[model samples]
Target: MKTVILVALLLLLFPIPVLGGESGLVISSYSVNPSTLFPGDTGKLVVTVTNTGTRSAEIREAVLYGNGLKVLSPGYSKLGTLTSGGSVDLTFVISGMKEGVYYPTLVVRGNDSTLQYPILVTVDSTEPEVLLDTGILYVNEVNRINFTIINPRSGDLTSIKVRPIVDGNVYPEYLYFDRISGGSSAKGVFYLYTTKPVETVQFSLQFNNGENVRYTNTTAPINSLPSREIQISLEKYPNEVLRYDTVVFSGNITNLRQDTIYSLIMSIEGDGIVSSRDVVLPALSSMDSVPFTIRVTPISSGTKHLTLTYMYSDVLGKIYTGSTDLYIQVPDKDVLSLNGVEIKKDGIELNIIGDVSNLGNYEVKGVTVSVLASDSEESYFIGALAPSDFNSFDINIPVKENTSTITISIQFVTGVGQLITIQQNLPVKEKPVLKEPEIPKKYYILIGLISVLVLVVVGYSWKRAMQ
Candidate 1:
């Protein structure tokens, strides 16, 4: 006592490519929800009715009409039976008043059998797209913007977020994405810095399609352009620093851009610095310059403060950093002077040779040359002396006896590293006095025959002292 099958939804100008006749109940699958629709959007048009053969099928009512797709879900007096191979599903709420494709139909009348089906609905308005993947954009430095998040519309799109408005200055207000699979595209990065002039750079796009909720507003235009400089040059550092000297800071690192530059790095920091060496470059072409050296030894003296940091990348990789500054003048350990001291004597020992010149312009490391006789002390090691360069040391020492003078020390190490020693006082040479051997002419003829026999015995004693 329950049988009502009056389903209809005809509107297919030239549809019917597959309609069932023997009535085993057909109309297998059909769907159209948020698949697409935007003129008045509000969708749902599902239909699935299958009975096949060998059986029970008695659907009483189901109706849906179509024009621009307006069927507002009404008829359904009694959509009840469908057993044998069984299946039944019919819903229709669709409302998208015009924009494009629409072909709805789904008739199902049992017993006399008449199951026709056809479903396809789409009413797009198309949105979602934001361009500008960086080519040039800079006014007051720092600008590597890139935004391209397109989902032109076909279906998938949800949660995806993007925000960047650079008049108030933005660097990453928000940029999230969980899904974006319609036509597809994704990439967003920002790091803007504008001090005065700015024309455009705003992009705000929100998403979600199935439940309907979307927004899009994009703008990418700015032609102020004037920010490109990465040419550090320290002039080979060395102005004048003698006291406790040990300062070096070399230069050259120009890569003025024409593209090609990635992962370049350079470092040097100071504040009483005593060691350093860092420089790596993975790539760098176009304008290339490279060459940097730093060797310090400052326990913080006077006006010293150094810094030279750097980072690079460009060619879609983005990142680009900078830093440069150095000021030096450490005066306090230079008063050493005792050039070319020489003292050679070899037997009682006492050599003390010389030559340890650097004359100041830079380079001077551990130049030694000691000597202190008697209580004994000898040394010589002059290493790394280059500026006018000169190295030579001899030291021997070993000649005592109240040891006159002879100190001679002379240690050096200045370049900001101070360790100087200078002493001088030499004198210790006196040992030569012995002259007695100048009477050899046969002893001068035997002293002249003993003076003529003492004058013949004094002339006979003067003739007998007068008788």
Candidate 2:
């Protein structure tokens, strides 16, 4: 009777093993569904435990642990008894897991044995979005754009990278992000400006989850208004004049812009002329005539072209150019003439003689004659010549011992303010005489007498000594 009871107990305790002692309790369907989950997102973990042992076993408990992760449901599963071939299923809800790889532990306890199972889970908390304030912008205008980041998972985000692609070029330096905390949301602003008419800009965003997003836009047309045009006009008074006549040319500049201009500059370009002073003109203003004088000599009797150029900067810093031309006719070469230049021992003087039939078309102002010595260190200024129908100036230059050559620079200033200068060179020659000193004939006669007296005395003394 005891043997019969023992056999029945053993049979009940050791029901048919699933593998007949081939393997112990094993996990058949042990996995977490949707292995990847973002921050603040929920995921399901399903584990299937099976008893492959040779004897019946009881499963006591199972637990799961991970950094910054929580289980929403009971992680433990109790199996009262497991037949030779029996399996149990356990499902757990996990939430609030940080962004990273996570490992959870699954423990199963039997009446005589304990088993451990490790499961891997990944939580992603990355939200990368690129936003701009305006799609179009004007040239030379400031534009601002804003960017925001979003994290879907409840896990804390660590680092973020942003890149701006402008004009087909990638610019990593233009990116801005937050570094204080690893929050799922961040905000930033971007300011941009351009000088060109049209441009295109692009930007990209990357998150810790290895996800990338790109955005692009075309800029609007940049308008540049036309600047004001400014110009200088030159006019000569009594355009035509006789030789040795003075001519006056006046300059004036007008600002055509609606805004004011500053630093007006005026210059003259031509042959046989002078330039007026530079005048500053106000906005939308006209400058009065500025006068410049030129003296014409008989030598400069011909047609000449005079050009006056003016430049100024407007209020907007735009430069403008302006210019004008004038035609001047000098008297015929015969009507205006220089008679003759003469040099003397006491001083040098230039004689200028000219006739103005009609004063021509221009008035004769004055004349200036200058005398320059070839050997002189400096040229002497003979004041202005007397202006009349017949003009003449006597330039007296003091003669010096070393005066060898003299140059007379004859300049005629006309009544109309025209200048003409002529130059002439003259040579001065002088020879020096030296006299030879005379020697007296009496000195030679005295020396010969003294020699004869010495010879007679010597002969007489020799004869006396011999006797």
Candidate 3:
């Protein structure tokens, strides 16, 4: 009984040795040397890893990886063995060149399980500014834009670029610089093309501080010229002329203000007129008159109302419009008229004659003359007639014994799809019939006496033969 008690006590004193599951490792604490940092700044990151299981853990090394942060110091460190509940500290020196929140991952291998630790770091901000030397923008010319990049943080800024966002187009979209030290500034130039007028323009600034990529956007007001500073005058050729005449128009654009103008264009528009050209001027100086001409031919005769429009830009590239009106008079024109008609008889056919005259400003086409009798019609084509000209035509038709009247038709077509017909009635007078000459009376009485004598001789010869 004493031996049993002694064994029990000994067994209780010394525990039995048994193999169990693998060891586990975890991150105990983590810290960044400088908790707060700005772009283009350098700082240290420290991480403490501990073995939390009952057994010892053999770790190969600790590795770190993250975006927006460049590792300046060694990223890997050898951690051979970690006893139960023991802790090890690992460090990395990293630099940030862009502004944002960054999460770094730490990996440790060679133990029963792979251990990963995630760390968060925040980077401060910096920005730049842009200004236009001129108050407003103008069309058809290049405008200079100025940019100034300032470093507000304690670190250096690099890869600084300022870009202008315009509604139309801009030359050299961006201005770039290599570096700008902290608390200092750098200058750049950007050429912009403001094809149209706008109220404001946006400028975007992109740059990299040692620790982060930074961005900023700003807007500025654009001053544009108004139409009140422009003067326009219109002059026309041959103030009083006939229809279809070529009207030459001259327009003068004068800049009343001291500011210079660009892209001066004049356009003329009206009804019943055709123009072959538009006037454009490259540049107009201050207080100067730019003259431009346009030729237009009027189609119809009447009062023609013409509108002249002028568009131009100021020194800053904004567009403005102005207009002027002019009135013209075109005289009326008479196109065609029927002169006269005549009819005569020739053998068994009747001849119808008529004359047509063209009195209009334009040529008349497809003119034809036809004689319409009671039964049928006979036509003679006259083809085309020039202005202020006349032509005579005759059509012959066979008529029955007593036809006394006939009608005439003159049909013509204008080039613009207008058909005109003229009609006239002519009286026909028949020629007098001729009478045969009467035979003489004495010749008829002599023939009667000869016939009686021949009859008396025949009777006497018959009576003598019978006796």
lDDT of 2: 0.52
The residue-by-residue lDDT of candidate 1 on 260-342, one tens digit each, is: 57788888777765535577788877678888776665554477777778888665556778887777776654433456767
Candidate 2 lDDT over residue span 19-62, tens digit each: 33344676666555444566655777887777766667776676
Model 2, runs deviating above 4 Å: 1-228, 231-236, 242-244, 272-299, 315-318, 334-467
For candidate 1, what is the lDDT?
0.69
| Candidate 3: tens digits of C-alpha lDDT, residues 1-467 | 45644553453343221123267576766777445466666878887777777888888877888766887876555578889988788888877778876767677774456665556666765445555556755444455556555666545667877777888667677778788776677766666655566777788878765445668797777765432466777664665534443556766778765556789888777886555467888888777987777765555678888787778886567787767776777777434556766677866689777678876545657998888775878899998888778999878898765777777777876534356666667778876568887768887787777777778788878888898
lDDT of each: 0.69, 0.52, 0.69
Q: Which stretches of candidate 3 lie over 4 Å from their true place?
A: 1-199, 205-211, 218-334, 345-349, 399-407, 417-467
Give each model a TM-score: 0.38, 0.30, 0.37
The residue-level lDDT of candidate 3 at 464 comes to 85
